[model samples]
Target chain A: MSGLAETFAAAAQEQRGVLIGYLPAGYPTHETCVSALTAMVRSGVDVVEVGLPYSDPLMDGPTIQRAVDASLAGGTRIADVLRTVESVAATGAATLVMSYWNPIEQYGARRFAADLAAAGGVGVITPDLTPEEGGEWLAATAEHGLDPVFLVAPSSTDARIAQIAGIGRGFIYAASTMGVTGTRDRVSGSAPQLVARVRTVTKTPVAVGLGVGSAAQAAEVAGYADGVIVGSAFVRRLLDSAGAEPETGVRAVAELAAELAGGVRQRRPRPV
Target chain B: MDPLPDPSGHFGRYGGRFVPEALIAALDELERAYQQARGEPGFTAVLDRLLASYVGRPTPLSDAPRLSEHAGGARLLLKREDLAHTGSHKLNNALGQALLAQSMGKTRIIAETGAGQHGVATATACAALGLECRVYMGEVDTARQALNVARMRMLGAEVVPVGTGSRTLKDAINEAMRDWVTNVADTHYVIGSVMGPHPFPMMVRDFQRVIGVEARRQVLERVGRLPDAVVACVGGGSNAIGMFHPFLPDEGVRLVGYEAAGEGVDTGRHAATMSGGRPGVLHGMRSYLLQDEDGQTVETHSISAGLDYPGVGPEHAWLRDTGRVSYRPVTDDEAMRAMALTSRTEGIIPAIETAHALHGALVLGRELGPEAVIAVSFSGRGDKDMDTAARYFELLDGPP
Candidate 1:
């Protein structure tokens, strides 16, 4: 099994949800992002996704969108993303890349897989590239022995879930809602049902993402999901704090990651 | 001669549903609804009546004798899409999609607009159908095309200004797509152009096909022969595809699509996707996109707000690759010049988007000489653009 699969397996054995955190590379600055991921890792995040910023992020809400836009304006490139991934991966957490498909398509999928693998990256989360259109990417990831994670939403049918499960390698990301990634007051009521639906088709571990912001929300998701994925919340923290003090921004993300990590480790017990 | 996009919505690997999983079911539902609606007798009857009465369809084909004489004596025929209700060809697709929304029992209609033409058209359709309407326009476009904003509001549609990510057509699309994802149950996203994920490119084209269908029959009946060439400007490529689809089988008719070249193609300040881009994915479809080396979509510039987009429709990419159509760029200077000449000679003012086609047609007319019968897709009227045109031409006396 791949290291990513092993991480999930270990988490399963521990009988607790795994906490996964996401941050865009070169957000604020390259060095700051590298330190941010390190701080997140130190705060008990079991895995980290270093986002490769793209110009058009259709699936992201305003928070991540603003972070990525700033990263791009700061001259963030694929190289910077890879460098951040390498530095973060050195912390021993299973590191993945969260990105749109175009950059990889432009970067040559095979070359991207090889470069990412060399950087200790274990997988890629492609928000836009469906399994139906991921033939070349699938082959490249297979060749590099890296995980090709795919997302399944509440709108996905059983057959569609099966098809995605058939292609997914690391884990199946289950979107908690039907909208773009952002912090919501409440996680959608449909998330647990969707995860249960996915479980009916594939044994692949399901990680719930989108709208997971607060620790309480993470704890709620951790009760039902194998993994809790938090993104826009962390991005919002960094963006809000970076205005005054960069160190405060980094500390804010780390503290939130730690709180979410605690939530995953000690999930709130549901009433009988 | 082939059915371009197969069942998977692929046009030679260009068009497909590359959107997030949240939008998949909505797209599938739209596809199913469109498939059923297109074949329903009741649906077609209402659509046909609406097209004739509400949209003022079967818009005339005008022979520009003076303009033709000015074009080195070649014959120029204008497919008067500019005369359509709401002053642009956008109403055709807007009305069709609005009716589709009505059929699906959707209460709200959402759309994204570049120059606000599509927003106004969608607002007009939603008003006619008694559905609530909202539009997302880039902050820059809303500022530039303020009159169109007023027109949309007057039609009872609310306009949301998108201030994120370049603040233009692309951002507006992103914002609208987000809205649809969040409100998929009660709202329908009426994509203005023939772009985005699957059903949209095909659906919008199907709605707008009346342009080519009418122009083809009119040209043959009036001129006693097929036109030598057809020309249209391509932004997201709705009008061009509409004007070109029915003529695809006509071997003798040459289809040319002109893209907006802001300064010049060589100057790196243009929206000529075909001329300046490589195949990539943006706005849910794999098409020729203007993006940087890092695959970040770059900001595009054009004097015409409608043409300032970083990507073209997937079908246009396929048509260009297949050599069934020719794509070229027209600089702002050339398009503006053609707009002035068209207004002066034909006494018909054209939207800046249409001026790109006029510029291309003028060049083609000069090349083909007086024997050639060229058809130009006059996509929109210039009343909304009079402010920009007057400012550019120094015709404005003072700040209004």
Candidate 2:
């Protein structure tokens, strides 16, 4: 079996908490993307998610959209994104791509899956690709040893949660709200309950995303699920430091990840 | 061969497929079906019967003598497309495409609309034909054109409001294209106008040709000859093409297309692509487009709901370039005034889109003189546009 999912699962088990980190590829510049991902892993991020920029991303809030626009303006393509992943994987950090469906369709699904897998991408998390429509993609992605992650929203029913979890191999993404992804002052009201409900279904690890901005929210979600994913907050940090030196943005994300990792490490159970 | 739109489907240099490899197969299929449907006797018979009985075709060519006298004594003939069933020429193309979809063994029809006119038309035809119908509109449009949204729902069509960028017509088109790409197996995309990738432009034109075909026969029977000038508004240019196609070979007939000048072309706030825009690619066709330097579509403004688009049909570009038809702009104030002028004088409330054509006839008639016979297409009725017109004219208050 591939060590990707096991690596994540083992980290969650050992830390008695979830590992979460984010990377907006081609942020500042594509030339520094690989180094950023490497810095994220070296700073103790368990799993890394590289965001693929889309022209029109309905699910993203302002902060992420601005980051995506900057990345696109810098000429980031799926090829460049996967190449960055390959370079980062050489340093041994498991990588997953989070993107909308348009670019994947534009690149041809089978070819995208094949190339990403070859570049050491472990999985893909497309917020918009529903399971009923993802059967062909599921087969294609599975063929290349790349797990296709699925998202279950608070609005999703128990049956839907199970259905998504069944098709999902990597961690199942649990959306914190009914609205698009954004930073929030607090974790969603139904997020913990939704994660708990998903636990009753397939044994797939659940990771709550969308609106979890601070280390406190990440630590809180670590108490419930396998992991917590932060995107908009990290993207905002990068945008703020855009005019500054290149390493500033990378160091910012790494600092946030280290802080969140510290919180998870403090609460984690001792391994048998 | 049609002398107006060449066999390659160029109005001059306007309409041709400028799409990726993924859509090429579908475009080719549509072109083949359209070409076959053109020469098929059964196809014409079915379309003709639908236009006659269902859509109430052979709409009167009423000589608007009162309105004519008001327009400097110029003779004006109204091609009553508004009198067609469902109160618009949209039904003509919708009914034809619905029939084609049924014949093609497709069980579902998908369409995208801006003001919901095309959605209502497609819904009505789908209800008539017992086919599943889905109409996508921008969320903003659904809110503004609520009555038409209700009309589509009442006709048993599923109305999906696209909530993407700007929440308007262009976004709705993008969403509809995505849906089509996903559901191409059993769904037939009934494009609303003579835009989009090839085959759609050609197919919609063929479906709408009845407008020109009937107007020609009606003009010959009524006036004993073709009109000296034919005028219609151009958005996606469907209604204009319907009225201009058959007369393309008629050397004596002069064709004029009216574009919407929202404020004024010089203010850079108009939908007058043919009048003020440059050649570019948009919505899968190369045409006269209102686009920025980066080829991003700019917002188009027009008082007329249907004519508010940043780009025009490819065929219209060809027609403008080849000098086969002259394109001019009618400002918002001009269209609104013409709407009231036609409504009060002729007791016919014309759609704002068609009012642009009437505004053109008012100007062209004086230039052509008293003996000039002019036919202007009344594309749709104004009932669907009462809210827009009432607000524009401030008719919310009691009589002025």
Candidate 3:
């Protein structure tokens, strides 16, 4: 099994949800990004998604958008992103690239797949490329032995979920809400129902993303979802601590990841 | 060749719903509604009535006899889209989308504008239909086209100034998409052009097809046959695509689209997507776009704010790929010269965006000879361009 699959299987055996952490590549700086992810994985994160920053991040809210913008402004290139992934993957966390489709399409799908795999990255989660348009990318990823994860939304129909399951290689990413990525006051009431719907279509592990921020929220999702994916909250910590010491920001991000991981471990599925 | 976009909403390999998962259901809903509306006669009747009475249809096809003199003996006929109710061709699409929004039981309309022409048009349509209206404009554009901002506000629309990433048309679109994602239940994003994802490119083209439909019949009536060539400016490419669609079946008519070359195509500072770009996805569809090696959208410069965009419509990209239409770049200086020449010769001023079409038509006319008839999409009146034109011509300095 792939490292990503193994990690999810291990967590499932323990009756705990897998904890996934996200950070944009080259955020703050390339070296700092690797350090932060290493710290995150050492403490808790089972999967680390290193974001390849694009200029127009349509799916991201203000928090991730600001970090992406700053990364772009700092001259963070695709090479930098790959380097960050290599460093993070060395820490034994299954690493993936979360990006809009254009960068991969522009970088040449086959070339991107080969480069990413060579850099020790496990897979990619393309937020924009649906099953309908993912044929070429899927072929390329398969050729390079890289997992291709896809997102299924709360608004997705049953037929669409089935189609996504047929094409997606890694665990399916379920957007918890019908909106861009951000920390909300409450997780959408539809998230657990959406996960249930995905299970009806495929036995693949279902990970809930988009609104899992705090430990309590992660625990709430852990009750139903196979994995808890948090992004904007980690970015918010880094952003909020930008003025303080760099070590302070890194520690805060790691500590939050650990706390969320604890929530996933403590909250066992209620006799399901 | 295959009835525009296929069932999957693809224009060749260009157009698709390359958006976030959150927007998928909304796009699906929009596609279903648009398909239903396309079939219903009542919808067409309502749109037709609104087009004829509310937005002013069948705008005249005027012959620019004096302007033809400079076209090296070729005759120039202007499809007077500039004379529409809102002084531009933007009203045609705005009103159609507004009516569609109403049919969907949506009460709020949101749109993004470049030079504010689309904003004013959308605002006017919303006011006419009693719908809530919001227009997103780039911070730079709100300053460059302040008058149009005032025009939109006067028409009872709120203007949102987006201050992000170059602060131009592209950023404005990003903000608008964000708003739509946040308020997808109650709000309808009445996309301003034939760009955006799926249904929008196809839907906006259908709404604006009135331009080519009328122009084709008028030209045949006036010249006793189809014009030898048709020219229009390409921004997000709505106007150009609208003027070219009906003429596609006529094998003899040549379709040409002019993109704004801010300085020159070689200067690396132009909005000429066709002249300098590669195929990539941005703002929901796969199209020809001006982007860097990392697929980041590049900043485009053009004197005409309307033409300062880095991407063209997906259909335009497909058309260019198939050799059905040709796209060329017109420099700022050349477009300005055409604007001045048209004003002096025909006693009619054209918007800077429209002047690019005029410039393209002049070039085509010179090549096609004296017996040739070239139809140009004079897309908007020049009233909005008085300040820029005056400054460029040094008329603002009082007869230099």
Candidate 4:
């Protein structure tokens, strides 16, 4: 099994869902990002998604988009992202890169896959790359012994789910509800159904993301999902703590990760 | 040439769906609705009638004898899409998309605009069709093209200024895509240009191709032959593709597209995508894009808000690669000069976007010499660009 699958298996053995955290590679500065990500892992995040900031982030809300914009402004190139992955993976958590497709394509699919694998990264979750346009990416990942993750939206048909699950090597990223990446007042009505439908097709673990803001929401998602992913909420914390001491930002992220980690552990069984 | 964009919407690997899975269902639905609409007499009849009665179609190809004489003596004919409803060619695609949305039972329409021309056109179409309309425009564009922003509001559409990523056309597109992803169930995204994912490029091209079709017929009847060259300005390349597609089979006629070179092609700020960029994926299509070594889309500048974009239409990229057409850059100064020249010589004020093509006609005219008959796609009028023109000519002080 891939490291991502093994991470999910380990979480399943704990009778709880995995806690996933996301942070742009070079928000504010690269050193601060590494310290914060390391803090997240130490605080019990089972998987780390180091964001590769792109100029156009269509799926992100204002908070994440602003953070990404600052990251790009700070000159966080592809190498910095890889260096980030290498640092975070040293903590022994499953590490993945979440990026738009253009950067990877520009980096040469084969080269990017090979470099990512060498950096100890386990997978990639590309939001913009559909299966139709994923030929070269799929080949590169397969050759590099790395898993590729694809997102399944609430609007995705059953056939699309099946097709995505069939080729997806790691856990399927289930975007909770609709809309871009942001915090919402409530969990989506469609999350449980999307997970259940995904269950009928592939046994690969399902991780729910998008709009998961707090520990309570995390708990709610963990009740049905194998992984509870939080992005904008974590980004909101870091963004708010942007100018404070580096330790303050790290502490803020650590506190939230610990809270969310507790949320996953306290979730009731899947009600099976 | 052999009816491009095969069943899957791949124009030789340049066009396809590169969007997130969340928007795929909407794209599929649109493709289905459009496929049905094009085949049914009920749909085509309504669209055609609207084009004739409302949009003032078959806009005349005006003869510009003085302008021709100024361009080294080539006979010049301008396809006056500027005469269309909403003062631009944008209404052609907007009406078609609004109609398609109505057919699909969608009541809300969303769009992204650069110069607010598309925003106004979409607003006008929605008002005519009795649907809710919202437009996203870049903050910078909103400030520069405030006239169009007001026009869209007067036409009953809500204008949302997007404040992100250079605050330009690409940012507006990003914001609109976000809104569409959220409201896909009840809304239709009317992409203003022949860019983006499948179905949009094909559909917008089909809607705007009426320009070339009418121009070709008009040119044949008046001049007794096809023009030696056809020129159009390209941003996301809707008007250019519309003007070039019908003439693809006319092997002897040259197809030329001019891109906005803000200062100069070498200046990093210019939006000369095909002239200065390489093939990459952006805005849901694989096309020639202005991006950095790390693949981040670079900020682009142009005097004309409409042509300030980082990517071009995928079909234009394919055509450039296959040598079926040629793309060059026209600097901001060149377009401004052409805008003035056209107004003075032809007594017509052309949009800065269309002025790029007019400048291309000047250069191509000089190259091909006296007997050459050159056709230009005058895509929009300069009414909305008066502010920019005024600022450019220093007429801001009430013209002295």
Candidate 5:
């Protein structure tokens, strides 16, 4: 099994869902980003999704967009993202890169796959790359022994879910709502139904993302999901702490990650 | 001739669904509604009635002898899409999508516009059909086309100015897509151009193709032969695609699309995607685009707000690759000069977007000589563009 599959297997043994924390590769500055991801890992983040800051982020909420803008303004490139994956993966957490589709295609597919593998990265999660458009990426990932994680939404029909389940090598990402990436006041009531639908279709581990912001919401999602993914919430913490001491922002993110990890480890009604 | 776009909405690997998975069911529903609407006379009757009575279909083809003289002596004919309601060919698409959305039980309409023509057209359609309308425009474009902002507001549409990433047409499109993703259940996004994922590119092209279909017959009746070349300006390529599709069967006729080169393509500031670009995906379609080495979309500039975008329509990308049609660029100065010349020679003030085609015709006229016939798609009028034109040409008797 690849490192990602093994990571999920190890989490399943512990009777707990994995806690995935995400932050852009270069936000505020490259050094601060590395510090934040390391802090998040030290606080029990099991997987790291190093975001590749992009120019036009259509699927993001305002907070993520503002953070990404700062990241891009700091001159983050694909090289920076791979370097980040290498460092964070050294902490023993499975590391994946969440990106929009264009940068990967522009940075030659084969070269990117090989370089990422050399960096000890696990896989890639493409929000815009659909199965119909993922033929090249699928081949590239398989050749590199990397997982090609795809997203399923609440709007996905059963047949679509089945197709995705059959193809998932890494955990499948289930968007809990039609909303973009932002903190929500409540965990979506319909998210459990979507997770139930995905479970019926595949043995592959499933993760729920989008709007899971707090410890309470993380605990709620851990009831059914195999992984609890937090993106904007982590970024939000760092953003709120900006203009303070550098270590202050890092500590804030570490604190949130520890709280979320506790929620993931909570005993739930559903079994792994 | 190849029976495209395919069932998956791809035209030779360019157009397909590249949207977030949350919007797939809605896209599938739209495709079904559109495909069924094409065959049912009940649907056609309503669409046709709207085009004929509401939009003034079968717009006239005017002889332009004086304007031809201003160009290099070739006989020039103007396809007057400017005469259509809402002052551009945008109405052709807005009405069709509105009717389709109504049939699908979608009560809310959303759209994005750069020049405000499409937004005005969409707002007009919504008013006529009694549906809720909301439009997204770049903050820059809203200020540039403030008259159109008032027009949309007066038509009962809420105009939202997008203030993100360059704050232009592409940003407006991104904002609209976000809105669609969040509210796909009861809303229909009326995409303005022949861009976007799947059914949108094909659907918009079909509705706008009347420009070419009517020009084909009218030219044959008025000029006694098909023009040697057909020209139109390309933004997201709706007007150009609409004016070129029906002429594809006429292999002898050359179809040319003129893209806006803000300064010039070599300066790297222009929106000349086909002229200076590589194939990449944006706004849900893989098309020729202006992107940096890292694949991030580059900032694009154009004197014409409509053409100031980094990406072109997917079908245009396919057409460029297959060598079925040719594309060229017209600089801001050249387009403005053409706009003024046309106004003086033919008493027609063409939209700056359409003036790009006019400039291309002037160049084509020089190559074809006096005996050749050229037909140009006058995509819109200059009423919405008065502010920009006045500033550019110092036509306002005010301080510079």
Candidate 6:
């Protein structure tokens, strides 16, 4: 079974909420990234997403882009990122490699998936890889026991949602906004509506991402999603704590994650 | 023969595949396809037919005698790119890519535009090919160039307003690149200029080189030898390179690149990267870029949206470094004045982006004298700039 499916299954049975934390692999430095992931896992992060930096990170917000740029400038490579994942996975926390499709295509999808699985990565969240073009990677990922997650935006049609959910193995990444990933003043109005729409299609766990930057936003999204993915906010905290104590950044994210996880756990079942 | 721009795609230290690992295979595939297509007679014939019939190529080399007389009687030949279908040289590259896209079995076309010229051109090609088209444009540009936006929509393109950072050309490009990354399977990104990573810069340049190829042949056929100088405006520097590449080996034929000096270079408002900027990497390649201390791209302003860019193409950088081309700045006021002069004398209203080259031609003409033949690439028509021109000249106050 895919590690992502196993993890989600385990979380669903235990009624334990999932906290997905994203960190650019080489931010500050590659050596620092290992410690960062370890700290995130130690601080109650259920799943750690190691971002593979790209030069043109179009879907990212300013904070994530800054982290990507910093990681890229620090000379981070795919090999280094995988190594970081291996080190983080040694701690027993699930690891997910989050990157754009270009980097994966450059690395040869099958080889990359096999290497990622060998490195102990549980899954991948390639936000830019559409389901229509995901056959090779999906097959490779399935072989490696690494789940290939797909994103469904609020604007995604019912047919697209069904297709994505049908093909997706780990969990459905629900983008909260119509545009790129970032922190916003409010969660998209259609996000909850879309989640309800997606629920009608498949039983797959849907993780809401993008604009879930604060505890309030995360909690709000967690009310509807099976998992909550916080990217830009955590990346921003890392940027703020750069050259300072890295644990401070990890702790801040941990507190935010713990708060949101509490909200998901406390959700009352709808009257049947 | 040129040895620098090898099959691997390095243009004299300017162009190469600087993309991340995930896209290497796609780039390699594209490179192979482009190589195969370049050598195929059928492919070339089809492209040629489209260029000739669809884009109305071999755009006239009009001798602007009246404008020449105004420039102190200096000989000025305008490579009339304005007469091309879609009213710009942008169509030439778009049509070539559209053909390639069709051959690749891609049914959707996506493009990024600053002033909407490339978007319109791409939309036109997509319409001709019966392909789905999406164009990303900065919100600011969409507002400034609304008529072009409507024109693109009329050509069956869905215009997506990019409301990202600065809401301009750079943001539009970022969004377009994002779309390409997500939709790489059935979509081909028809990049506008000689920029971007690896194959895009090289491919776009090859498509645009037709401009210089025809211009060079026409100049030679008309004057018996190469003109003394070739000049064109540089934004991402595609048009400049299109006019300069064929004449690179001709030592006597000086190439001049004119850049937009928004207010003035010292005022920190100009888009003249070669004149006032330093070498830095942006949008995939290292080139002369306008950037902050933190390496962030800086905001640029020009009277012409098409010319307002923070970086010049890598080839232009190499040319500048090699001293093969002289890069100079023309102020917004100067370009406007030149536009007026050209319209009045030659009855051809040039886009403000192209007027930079016109301004440069007038300056160089006086210095080189009337006997010196000069070819200036008139990159696009001024119709799209009519709104800005009306505001600039206060035509709204009186005209019905």
Question: Tens digits of per-residue lDDT for model 4 on B1-400?
Answer: 4677877778896988889899999999999999999999999999999999999998999999989987899998999999998889999999999999999999999999999999999999999999999999999999999999999999999999998899999999999999999999999999999999998999999999999999999999999999999999999999999999999999999999999999999878799999999999998999999999989999999999999999999999999999999999999999999999999988999999999999999999999999999999999999999988887898765535
What is the per-residue lDDT of model 4 for residues A22-131, given as tens digits with 9 covering 90 to 100?
Answer: 99899868998999999999998999999999999999999999999999888899999999999999989899999999999999999999999999999999999999
Better of 3 and 6 by DockQ: 3
- Give the CA lDDT, 0 to 100, for residue B78 in model 1: 98
DockQ of each: 0.83, 0.04, 0.70, 0.90, 0.83, 0.07
Instruction: Provide fnat values for all models in the order shown.
Output: 0.76, 0.01, 0.67, 0.88, 0.80, 0.07
Model 3 chain B: weakest 10-residue lDDT segment is B391-400
Question: What residue runs in model 4 are displaced by over 4 Å at the alpha carbon?
Answer: A269-272, B396-400
Name the regions of candidate 5 deviating beyond 4 angstroms: A267-272
The clash count of every prediction, one per candidate, is 0, 8, 0, 0, 0, 8
Misplaced by over 4 Å in model 3 are A268-272, B397-400
Whole-model lDDT, model 6: 0.82
* Second chain TM-score for model 6: 0.97
**Candidate 2 runs further than 4 Å off:** A1-272, B1-13, B397-400
DockQ category of candidate 6: incorrect
C-alpha lDDT of candidate 3 relative to the true structure: 0.91
Q: What is the lDDT of residue A172 in candidate 4?
A: 95
For model 5 the local lDDT of residue B216 reads 98
Report the C-alpha lDDT of model 6 over B1-400, residue by residue, as the tens digit. 5665667566676666543322444566677888899999999999999899888889999999999987667789999999999998999899999999889888999999998999999999999989999999999999999999999999889999987666788888888876765567688889899997778877888899999999999998999989999999999988888888888989999999999999999999989898888766566666778865434567889999998888888888988999999999999999999999999999999999999999999999999987899999999999999999998887786655
Candidate 3 local lDDT, residue A84: 94
Alpha-carbon TM-score of each model against the true structure: 0.98, 0.65, 0.97, 0.98, 0.98, 0.69
Give the top-scoring candidate (DockQ): 4
Candidate 6, superposed: residue stretches over 4 Å from native:
A1-42, A45-252, A255-272, B398-400
